[model samples]
Target chain A: SAVISQKPSRDICQRGTSLTIQCQVDSQVTMMFWYRQQPGQSLTLIATANQGSEATYESGFVIDKFPISRPNLTFSTLTVSNMSPEDSSIYLCSVAGQGVGTQYFGPGTRLLVL
Target chain B: AQRVTQPEKLLSVFKGAPVELKCNYSYSGSPELFWYVQYSRQRLQLLLRHISRESIKGFTADLNKGETSFHLKKPFAQEEDSAMYYCALRGTGGYSTLTFGKGTMLLVSP
Candidate 1:
């Protein structure tokens, strides 16, 4: 099992503003992911952040709207850009441990865009 | 495309009652299924996985490839067992991304 933490546990941002959520893992991991959970909706994968490479984003999510940066194995960041009311959701960061299928999630960042 | 479906959004059961949270998945190849739980103020944590075939915190889940389902079950539920549960699938493809189902909130009332 791995321990993960996210910064800005909860934030209220004005529309059109941007907020970057940080994810830190206690151990180095090769696979890190970003997810979004909207009100009453399932957790949706936003992107896969790999160290020193471009992130692989899922459908319906674009790089321009949610940019990701993973400078190293233990850290990654997801920036919600040009936020709107619809973008208000709980953003989660998860990391998969080596040779294991289980992924541990961070304490989600609850963003409320006003 | 891999997908997970959790039919129930909420489930309420009395303490010490049997509880089952249904989860079904759609995947072509071998699937790695997992059950994650989130307590009221805690982070989402892996409760159990089918591949491990082990029980955690008195909870267990079995993968039924024939039915394409992996449902979580617990006998004699406890009040502390109340939490938001999510069923997730890991695709075997190179990406190793996880697709999660809509979570189920289990309310074990004492």
Candidate 2:
């Protein structure tokens, strides 16, 4: 299992502001994914970040809203742009293990837009 | 569309009681199921997977393809088992992103 560390564990941001959450894995990985978990709701996949390539965004999520960056195999970033109150949620970063669909997750960044 | 369903939002059981957290999936192709747990202050982590066919922390889940169910079960619930459990299914896309269900919060009281 990989140990992932995400920065800004919890943050309070004003509407119209943007926040970039960093995810650093202890070891190199092939794929990293970002997810959004609204309060009392299921997780929704935001995008998949692969090194040196454009991310694949899921339905309802667009790069203009959630821009992603993957500089290398062990690091990635997800920026929630022009945040709104509705953007308040827990953002998690995960990596797919080599052998299976099993994923390891970061501690998650809790964003509260006011 | 690939999706996961966790029917119970919350389940409360006494210690030593049997517990079952139901999960169901909808997918057109072969599906891979996984159970992830999040303790009070911990990251969401994989507990077990249907493909591995192994039990973790005495919790077992059987994937019934015909029923599209992969319910998590344990014979005896413990206080430490209190946590939020999420059932996830692999999407058919390359790299196989996961589609998680609304988690079930299991509160095992003594």
Candidate 3:
């Protein structure tokens, strides 16, 4: 398992504002995943960020709405643009382990839109 | 398409009682099941994975391909065992993406 951390563990932002959540991993990883868990809801995949390539977004996620930057193997950023109340959720970043089907999660960034 | 289902939102049990957290998944390819636990104010950590077929912190989950289920079990409950348990599934392949369940809140009463 890798040690992962997220910045701005919890934040309150006004509507239409944007917040960028940063994820840092202790070791280099080939794949970084972003997930959002809404209040009382299941975790949903937002995107997969791979270094040196544009992120691959999930079905309901888009680059324009949730932009991602995989600047390097150990870091990635997810920026929620034009945020609204519905966008409030706990955003988490995770990294896959060396073994297949294994993943470790970060502490998660809790976002609240006012 | 892949999905994990945890039917119980909350499961309350008295200390020393047996505990079981039900999980079911749907996937076209070979499925791998995992149980993750998040204690209060703690990051989510892996409790058990079907591939390992091993127990951690007194918890074990058996993968029943026939029923499409992978329910977590513990012979005896401890107060410290209380936490949010999430069942996750990853399809067989190069893809490492995971589909997580809604999570079940386990409350072990002393």
Q: Highest DockQ among the candidates is held by which one?
A: 2
Q: What is candidate 3's lDDT per residue for A1-114, written digit by digit as tens?
A: 799999989999999999999999999999999999999998898988999999988899999999999999999999999999999999999998876667889999999999
TM-score of each model, in listed order: 0.95, 0.98, 0.97
Per-residue CA lDDT of model 2 for B1-110, tens digit only, reads: 98888989999999999999999999999999999999998889889999989999999999999999999999999999999999999888678688899999999999
* Cα lDDT tens digits for candidate 1, A11-109: 999999999999999999888999999999988999999898999998899999999999999999999999999999999999876545577889999
Residue B100, candidate 1: how far off, in angstroms? 0.7
Using DockQ as the measure, what is the rank order of every candidate, best first?
2, 3, 1
**Residue-level error in angstroms, candidate 1, position B101:** 0.7
Residue-wise C-alpha lDDT for candidate 1, range B4-108, written one tens digit per residue: 999999999999999999999999888899888999999888788898899898998999989999999999899999999999998765876788899999999
Ranking by lDDT: 2, 3, 1
Q: Candidate 2 — which pairs collide? A: none
Off by over 4 Å in 2: none
Report the CA-based lDDT of candidate 2 relative to the real structure: 0.94
Q: Which regions of candidate 1 are displaced past 4 Å? A: none
Q: Which candidate model has the greater DockQ, 1 or 3? A: 3
Q: What is the RMSD, in Å, between candidate 3 and the native fold over all Cα? A: 1.1
Task: Please state how well chain A of candidate 1 matches the true chain A, as a TM-score.
Answer: 0.96
- Which candidate leads in lDDT? 2
